[model samples]
Target chain A: MNKWTKLDNAAIVFPSLAKAKNSTIYRVSAVLKETVLPVRLQQALDITVKRYPMMTMRIHKGLFWRYMEYDDEPLRVKREDDYPCHPLQDRMTMEALLKVFYYQRRISVEVFHAITDGSGAMEFLKTLVYEYLRLLGKAVEPEDKIRTASEDIHPEELEDSFHRYYTPGRPPKIRNTKAYQITGTYFEPYGNNVTQGVVSASALRQIAKKQGATLTEFLLALLMYTIYRQSSQDRKDQRPIKVSVPVNLRQMFPSKTLRNFFAVALFEISSQQEQSLFKILCAIKEQSVKNYSKKVLQEAIVRNINLEKIKIARFIPLPIKDIIVKNRYFLYNDKLRTCTMTNLGRVDLPKTMTPYVDRMEVVFYPTANNPLNCGLCTVNDNMTISFSRTIRENRIIGEYFRYLSQEYGLEVKIYSNEWGISD
Target chain B: MNGGFQINHCIHCQVTVEASLQECPLCGKKLTNTRLSVPRSYPAYALHNKSSYYFQLFWKTLVPLMFIGAFLIPSLITLLTGEGDLWLNRETLGIASAWVLVRYTFLSRMHMGKKFLLQIMNISLALFIFDHVGEARGWSVNYVIPFMLICSTLAMMYIVYKRKRLWSDYAVYVMTLIFLGFLPSFLYLIRVTSLLWPSAAAAGFAIVSLIAVYFFLDKNFRSYFNRRLHF
Candidate 1:
C-alpha cells in the first residue's frame, strides 16, 4: 500500500507500452560477482523497492486499471536454476527467462512499465550491480557520473503516496493515429527470450549532435525511418509509419508510487516523400516532448491517481474491478498508437560500488499482444538497444539497426539470441 | 491549457518556432513549448478529407473474416462435444460468413462505429438461420460451408450495387449489421473454445485491415502499398 509513496523520487520514470500485450514483462540481466551484495547497494534496492512496492504489485482487480498495492509481501527472486534461459534461433539471439529469479551466476528481473519507466529501472539495475561488485571488494568509478552526494532526501517531503511530481492538468485528448505501414499481423511467442545489443553512450550522443538532433530524437528517427523503409517496399500503397514512445508521467505529474505512471505519444513519418533524416528527427522530438505541456501532464497525473484511489476506497468488489480492467484492454488497444520505443536514459549508482561494475544492458519485451518491442538502456558511457517480438520480423529489426548506422554515422553493433557480433 | 500559449527553441539547430507550429518549421527540430493562445487546428472536419473507399472493402472484409474463421473453425470443433443450440450454431456461422461479405461489402463504406455495429447485426440474422438449419441436421458449419456463403454473399452484394453506388459506403452499413449479429456468436465461440484462433484471427484481421484500410481506403491503399512495398 505504501508503494505509492515511492513516487516522490525525482528519478522514478516509467513508460507504459501496450505494443505487445501478452509479452508485457521487460527484463534486464546483469552478471553479479558471486560474493555477497554490498550493504549500500542492498539498502538502495531495499529502499527503492520498499519505496515503490507498486512496481512489484500485481493487478488484484480491474482490467484496464489493474493496479494493486502489495506492501507486506517480500520481493520474489528466482534462482537461475529454477528458471533457465531459453535461447532462440535466428539473427536476433534472444534468451527468455521465465521471470525474475536470482541464482549463483546471473539474476534476471522482470518489470512492467505500469510500475516505472526505463530510466527508473536502469537506475535500480546500476545500483544493484554496483552494490554486488562492491561486496566483492572491487574498486569502481562511473565514467559518466554526473554528480555525487550523500543521502540527499528532501526532508520536508511528506510520505504522501499521491503527491504530484509534474505540473497538474487534464489528460491530453487522445488522437486517432493512422497506421502508415502495411504488414501482416502476428502474435508474440509465449516463451521468454531476450536479445541485447550495446553501443557506447558518448558515441551515440556524438552521432546525435553531429546530426543536429538530441540522442532520443536521433534514435527514434532512425527507428521510424527504418521501419518505414522496410514495411513499405513490398506494397504499392504507402502509409505513414508510426512509432509509439512511452512518456514518463513522473516528470510531468506528481505521483511517488511504483504503479503504472506513464502515457504514450506517437511519432509519425510518411514514406511517400523523400524522407529527410534531420526533419524526421525534429518531428519526432517535437511530438514526443512538446505535444503535452508540463501542466497537461500534471493534470493527467492527478486525475488518474485520484480516480484509482476513489475506486479502491469505494469498495467496488474485486470481480467488478477485474471486468473493468479486461475491458480496458480493448479501449487502450484502439486509443494507443502503434509500436513502442522506450528510452531509459542514464542510470546512477552508489559511490562505493563503481569500479568492478562494467556497463549495463536493458531489453523491453512488450506484452504478447503488441506489434513490436523496443527498449534502450544506458550505463556508464554505453547504451544497449534491445527489441523483442512474438512474431519474427528480422527484416524490420535489421533495417532499423542498419539505418541507425548509415544515417546517423553511429556504428551499431548487432547482437541477438541467435547471432551477435562481439566487440 | 496554459492559455494555449508559450515560447520555445529547438534543443538542436537553435531553431525558434512559435507555439502554433508543431515542428521548428525551419530546421525542423521538435519544439518543447506547445502552449499557445490559439490551438493549432487541422482542416475543419479532417475526416471529410479522407480518400474514397474502393478496394478498401476487400481488405476490411478479408481482414475481419479471416480472424472470425480462424476462431469459428476451432470453436465449432469444440462445440461438437459441448452443449449448444442449433440457433447458436447457425447464428455464429451465419454471422461469421455474412461478416466477411459485409466487411467486403460495407465497412469500407461506413466510417461510424454505431453504423458498423448495425450492419453486422443485419447479416447475423440470415447467417444464424442458415447455420442452425445445417447444424440441426448434424452438419457442422465449418470450413467450406461458411467460407462459401461469405464469399458468395460478398460478391453478390457488390453485384447488386448500381454503377452509381459506391462500394465503400454500402459495405459500411453491411459490416455494421454483420458485426452486431455475429457478436453473440463470437462470444459463444470464445466461451466454448479454449483455442485462441478466433481471437487471434479477429485481432489479426483488425490489425492487417487497419493498415490496409489506412492505405487502401483512406489513404488510397493500393497506391500506398505499392509505393511502400517496392522500396
Candidate 2:
C-alpha cells in the first residue's frame, strides 16, 4: 500500500500536454568545483529523497485524474547521457517523477512538471548537493538553510497551497489575444539545446535600477525589442510579443508548501507604430507593476482553480479527459504567449557550502507552441541566463546576449550543450 | 569556472562567447584563439544517439502505414473487379481485427486484469459478428459466447485469488465479468439463445459465485465500490 496525493491545480495540465517532442521536464543543475562521484551521489540521493518525502513518489493515473503514489524504494541516480530535460519515460510505472543525473562536474535534477515547480526542484537540488558534499568529507554545514536528513517532513510541505488560497465563485474574466509567434526550422534530431550567458548579477541590477525597471522587466523588454527589431517589414508582423512570466506565490502568501504554488503573469508588448527600446521598457514597467500586485495574482489563482471545479469536468473518465486536455490545452494556452521567461531570483546557499559549488543553472523546457524559453538563476554574483530552445534559428538568442554584453559592457561568459550547432 | 585564458573573441559580434570553439556559434565567424584550454561546462551532445527515438517513431509510423495499405489494396482490387460493394469483406475484417487486437495487447500499458477482460470481450464480439453475418448460425450465442463468459469469470476469480493485494483494484472488473455471465441466461429467456445447457452453466456459475462473494467478501467490495462509483 502507498500513500497517494492529488496533482496541484497548476500541475494537472502537464501530464496530458506532454509528448515526445514537447517533454514538460525542467532541470536545475549545479556545477561543482570537483568531479562528481557516482557512488557518493547515489548515497546522497537516497538520503535526500528521504528528507523531502513530498518529492519521493511516482505519478499514477487515477479514476478521475492523475495522482502520486509513494514509492518506498530508493530512486537510482544515473550518469547523464541524454540531452537535457528529455522526457521521463517511466511515467506510468513505479519510477520516481524526479531523476538525478551526473555528468563530470555537473549534477542535474530533471523533474516532470506534474510533480513540482521550479522552487520545489531548486530546494531538492540544494539538499542533494549538500548531502553529496558532506558525504565526501567536505566541511559543509546545513546552517539551517538546507533540509538535512534528520529533519522530519513537514505536513505543510505536502499541502496544495492553491486550494487553500483560492476563493470559490470568484472567477475573474481574462482577455487573451493571439500573440506574434517566433518561427524557425525545427532542428533535426529533436532535442533541447541550451546556451547560457553568465554575467555579474549586481552590475546588471545596477543598470536595471538606473532604468527604473526590475531585472526581469528589463530582460522582458530587451527580449521583446529584439524580436520587434527582427520582425519583417509587413504590418501583420507587428503583433504583441507576449512573454509568460511565472510569479512565485510564496512571496505573497505565507504558505511554505514545496508543491506548485506559482501563478503566471503574461508580460505583453508590441510596436504597431515605430517605437524605441526605451518605450518598450516603460510599457513593460507599467504592466509589471500592475500585474505584480496581490489582487491580480489572486485573480490568477482563482481563475485556475475554477477551471478544475466545473461540474462536468469532475465526472469524465481519465482517458477521455486526457484526450480532451491534449487537444484543447494549446488552444487556451501557448497561443496567447510568444514564449516564457521564469526568473528564480537569487539562490542563497549556506556560507559553509559556498566554496564547493561553482554556479547554478535553471533550464526551462521548451514546448511545441513556444519553441524557445529563457530561465534566469543567480548564485553568488553570477547570473546565468540560459536559453533552452528546440528550433534552429537563434537570432533572438544571439542578439539578446550581444546586447547585454555590448550595451551594458558586462563581461559575459558563455557555454552551450551544442545539440545542433554545425561546428 | 572562468578557467579559460584563451579569448576566442568574435570581432564580427564584438563579444566573446566560448573560449574553446574555433568559430563563434552565433555568427559562424572564425574566432580561433588558443592559449589555455578549459574543460566544458556541458558534455558535447553533438554525438546524438538517434536509435531509440527513431526506432519508436519508425514503429508508430510503419504500423499505421501497414494498416492503411492492408485496407486499400483489397479495396482497390474489389473496385477494379466490381465484385463487391463492401470493401472489407468478412475475411478482411477478421484479419484487421486480429492485427488490432495483437497491437493493443502489446502496446497498452493498462492494468493486466482489465486488459485480459477487455481482450476476451473483444474476441467474443468478433465471434458474435461472425455468426450474425456469415450463416446466421446459433453457434455464437448457443455455445461460444456463453462458454467464453464462463471461462473468463473463472479466470478472473483465479487472478483475484492470486493477487489479493490488488484485489480491491480488480474487484470492480471481476464483478463486472461475473455480471456479464448472466447475459447468456437472459438471451435464453428472450429465446434468442435456444440451446439451454450452455446458458444454464454460465448463469449457474455466476449465481454460485455471487452467493459465495456476498457471503465471504461482501464487506470488502461494498466499501471499495462505494468510493469508486461515487460520482
Candidate 3:
C-alpha cells in the first residue's frame, strides 16, 4: 500500500481555489548549454521522482480535508507544447502534482502550489539536472546540498514544518481593509503572455547599493511606481498599491522539509502622497524589514495555524469549507494585493555543473481575477525578471523596463513567448 | 572575419559562435551580440486567435436562447389556440425544472460527493413541487425522499468501508448521512402523512447499519473515530 499523508496548513487553501484561470501553479526552468535529450531526461526524471516522493503523490479527497497519497504511476517527461503554468487536472493525466517538460535547451518543472513552494521546487530542479548530467556521463558532484536519487529519503524532508514550528498563542489579527486593484481585459483562450527581461546582476546591484536598498526592495519599489503611473491620476481617493511578497520561511526557522513553507508579506506604497523612487524604496525597505522579522513572521505562522486549529473549522465538511475558503481568499488575498512579486533570490548550483547551465527563470500563474504577476531569479550574475500577465495591456511592463533603462542606465535584453494580445 | 562572417558570444554560457545563427551553437540560448541598437530574440509581433473566446461567447449566447425557446413555443401555441386548459403550461414548468437540474449536474465543477448531495437536494425539491401542483399526493414526502435518503446513506457507507485508508476522512460524512436517514422517521412521527412504512424502513436500515459498523467492524470504527476526533 502507498503511504499517505495529510496536507500541511499552508497547502490547505490551494486545492480549493485552483481553477482554469487561477491554477496556483508555478514554473522553474534551467537552460542548459546543449539541447535537451528526451531519453536521458526521462531516465533522470524517473530517478528524481523517487527521491522527492511527495512531489509524485496525487491529491485524494477526504470528508473534512484532502490528503496526499503515493501514486505508482510513472512520471514522464514531455516536450513543451502548451503555455507555462497550465492547470493540472488530475483526471486528465498521471495524477501527479508536478510535471517535467523540456524544450530545446531548457528543462522546466511546473508544480501546483499545493505540493511545495519555490525553495522546494528549486531543490528538485537542481537534483534533476545533476542526475541528468550524470546519466550523460558528465562529471557532476553532489555538493552535499543536492539530495541525489541514490540516497535514501530522509524523514526530515517529509516533515510538516508548520506543525513542527507552531507555538500555542493568540495570533495577531489583520484588518481586511481593501487595497488597490488592477483591472484589464483578459487575454483570449485563457493564456498568459510571458515576457522576460534579462539584465546584468552587477548593474542592478550597483544601483541598489547606491540607493541603500537590496535588489528585492529596489524591484518592489519599481513595481509600485509602475502601477501608480498606470492607474488613473484624476481620482482624489487612491488606495495604497500593495504588493504581496512571498517570504521563504526556511531562512528563519531550521527545517529541511520540502513542502509549502512560506508566508506572504504585503508591502504597500501609498498613492495619497506623491512619492519619488527613493521614497518608495524606503517604504518597501521599512515594511519588508518589519514583516520579515522573526517576531512578525512567528505571528504570521501562528495566525495561519490557528485558523486550521479552530474546532469548528475541523468539523466543517470539505465541500462547504472549499466554498468558504475560496471566497475568503478571493476577497482578502486577491483583492488586497495589487499584484504578487515572488523573488527566488540567487540560485547556486554545483561548481562542476555551473558551466553546463546557462540561466534560470521562474514564472507564476496569473489568478482568475488578477491578470499580472512577477517572478525573479538570478543565476551566475544574470538576473531574469519574468512577467506573466493574462491582460491585453503591456504598458506597465513596457514602462517598467523603460524606467530601468532611462533612470538606471541599464540595458535590458528582452525575450517573449509573444501571446499576441493587443491593447 | 572568415568568409565575411562575424561572431557573437553568449553572455550566459560564455560560448562564442557565428553571428548568422539566431542562437548559440553550443547552448540553445539566443545570442546577445547584435548590429541593431536593441536586440530581441523572438519576433516582435504575434497574431491574436480569438476562437476560444468566441467558443465561450457562442455558449453564452446559446443558453439564453434555448431557455427562451423552451418557454416561448409552448406558451405561444396556447395563446394562439385559445385553449382553456393550463396543464400544458404546468407541464412546461416541470420540464424546465428537470432541464435545469440536468444542466446543473452536468455544468457544475463540484466534486462527486458534493454533486451527489446537490442531486439529492434538487430531486427532492422537484418532487415536492410536483406533488403539490398535481393532485397534492404525498408520494414525494413518504416515498421518494425517504428512499433517496436511504440509498445515499447506504452508498456513503459502502464507499467509506471500501476505502479503508480514508475511512477516518469520510467518518463525518457517513455520520451525517446516518443522521439524515432518520429525518424521514421524524416527519412520520409528526403525522404529516398517512404513510409510515418507508420512513420506518429507512430509519431502521440506518440504525442497523450504524450498529453493524460499530459492533461487527469494531476495530475499523474505533480507529476511524480516534483519528477523526483527535484534538
Candidate 4:
C-alpha cells in the first residue's frame, strides 16, 4: 500500500480483452517419503503469509476490479484415505499417510492477476511444500539465500541468468487489427476453483529447442495452429490470429510488491492458409521469442505506466478516470487478432527439497468471458500443453496435443477426467 | 366604484375581511366599515375527483344538504296543505342550520362546485328511481333501497380512488348505473329547486356539458385556479 510497494506492482497484467476472466493453475504433486502433519502445512502457510501476504485471499469483486490480501485462511489439502474425497485431488491419491491441510482443509487461495503472477505464486507454493516437509521431521535444508535477500535486486542480474540459460530470441511479428475478445467458461465439477494441468517445463524446452524455437514460441505456435485447425474445419473465414503473452515487469520497474507486476506482449500469426502442425508451431516459436525480448518488454511497460500516470494526473475522479482509460484501452483492442498464450517459466523448487518432491504442473482456465483456454504445464523434463474444451470444442485441444507427440516426435501424454469426457 | 362590492376591516382585529361579511369569523372581531376592495381567494387545496374530497363533500355537504331538504320537502308539502307553523321553530331552525353548513363546506371551493352539483343530481335521481320502481310494484319505498344506493356510491368512489385506474376504465360503469337508477329524484329536484334550473332533465344536460368542458378544455384549469386562489 506504500508508494514503493505500489511502484513494484505497477506492471500487473491482464489477458487480452478476450481472456480477461481467465485464471491459470499451478498444481504440484509431491510424494512425501514420510507422513507430513497438517500442522506443518499450516506453519508453512503462516510463514508464507507473513512474507507474501497477497496470495492468501480470494477475488472479492465482480468480473474485474481485483485486489489482494493475506487476511484469509490458507488453502487446504485433501487426504485420499478420507471417504468420498474431493474430485480435484483424486490424481494425487495416497493409500496411507497424514495429509497436510493448511488453515483447515476446506480453504482456497484464489489470486487475482493484480496481486501476483503465476511464477510468484508457484514460488510461494514450492516454499510452502518445502516448509511443510521440514515441520514433519523430514530431512530438509532451508532456502537461506532467498529468505535473507531483499526484493530490491537489480533487473540486469536477474535477466542475466535467464539469458544465460535461455537465449533471448527475437519476438514474433504480430499481424492483426482487431482486439481478441476476453472471456471465461465455468465448469461446475472442477470443484470450487480448478483448471486442468498439462505440460512439463523440460519437455516444452526440449521440444522448443528442437524446433529452433523457445518454449513460449513453441506453445504459441501450438495454440495458433490448433485454433487455425479448429476454425478451418468449420469452413469459417480464415482470419489472422493474435495471442496475448504477459511480460513480467518486476525488475524493469523498481519494486516487488506481490500485487500485479506484469505488462503484455502480443504474438500474432496469420492464418491466410492452412498450416501443417510442425509449420505453425515453428512460426509460433519464432514470433513469440522475438516478441518477448528485454527491449520489447521494457517498452511495453514504459508506454503503459506513463499512460497510466498521465491519465491519473488528470483532475477527473477515480471512477470517471477508470472509465476513460478503459474506453481507450478498448479502442486499441480492435487491432488484436486472436487469443492468449501465457508461458510461466520453469517452476523451480528448493535444491534440498527435490528428494521429497517430484514435479509441478500448471493448468490455466480462462473465464467463460473469454473464448479461448490454452494451459501450459512443465514438470520433470516433460511438458504438456492442455487446453480446456468447456468454451470451444474438445477436438482442437485433442488434435493439437496429438500432433505435438505424433508429428514432432515428442513423447506427449494426454490425461483428462473420464478420458476427454469432461464430467 | 362606489356601487361595486366593498371589502371591510374587522373593528377588533383590523384584519382584511370579506365584502359580504357583517362580522369577522376569526378572533371574534367585529366589522366597523365597508370599502370596495378585491375579494382575495380562500386558500384551499381542492381535488374534485379524489376520495377524501368526495368523502368530505358527502359528509359535510351532500348528506347534510339532502337531509335538510328531506325535512324541508315534507314541511313544504305540509305548508301547502295549510299547516305553515307545523315545522317552524324546532324543525325549521334545524334544517336552516344544516343548509348553512352544507353551502359553506361544499360550495366554498370553485373547483369542487360543478362536481358537487352533479353528485347531488345523481343522488336525487337514484331516489326518484327507487320511489317509482316501488310504486309500480305496489310497494312502499323501503329503507334498505336508499341505504344501499348511498353505500354503493361511497363504496364505488372508495374503489376508484384506491385502485388509481384510469377514469375511462371503470368510471363510466359506475356513472351509468347511478344515472339509470336516479330517474325519479331527477324529476323531483328539477320541479322543486329554483336555483338549479327548471327541470332535472335540463340540469342533467348542463351537468354533462360541464363535465365535457372540464375534461376537454384546452386551458389548464388547475393552474388557473392555483394562480387565482393564492393565499
Q: Compare the candidates by TM-score and give the number of the best one.
A: 2
The alpha-carbon RMSD over the true interface for every model, in angstroms, is 25.7, 3.5, 10.0, 46.3
Give the C-alpha miss distance for residue B34 in model 1, angstroms: 52
lDDT of 3 at B81: 91
Which 10-residue span in candidate 2 chain A carries the lowest summed lDDT? A87-96
TM-scores, all models, native as reference = 0.51, 0.87, 0.77, 0.48
TM-score of 1: 0.51
Q: Label model 4 with its docking quality class.
A: incorrect
Clashes of 2: 0
Off by over 4 Å in 4: A1-37, A54-109, A143-176, A179-207, A250-257, A285-289, A311-314, A321-337, A417-423, B1-231
Q: List residue ranges in candidate 2 displaced over 4 A.
A: A168-172, A232-235, B1-11, B14-23, B28-40, B44-49, B76-91, B105-122, B125-231
Per-prediction TM-score, chain A only? Answer: 0.70, 0.96, 0.97, 0.68
- CAPRI quality band, candidate 3: incorrect
Model 1 agreement with the true structure over A109-168: per-residue lDDT tens digits: 566544445544554455455444534467754444411122333322234234545334
Order of the predicted models by DockQ, top scorer first: 2, 3, 1, 4
List the pairs of residues colliding in candidate 2: none
Per-model tally of clashing residue pairs: 124, 0, 0, 58
Candidate 3: segments with Cα more than 4 A from true spot? A90-94, A232-237, A420-423, B1-53, B56-61, B72-231
State the local distance difference test value for candidate 2: 0.80
Q: Which number leads on DockQ?
A: 2
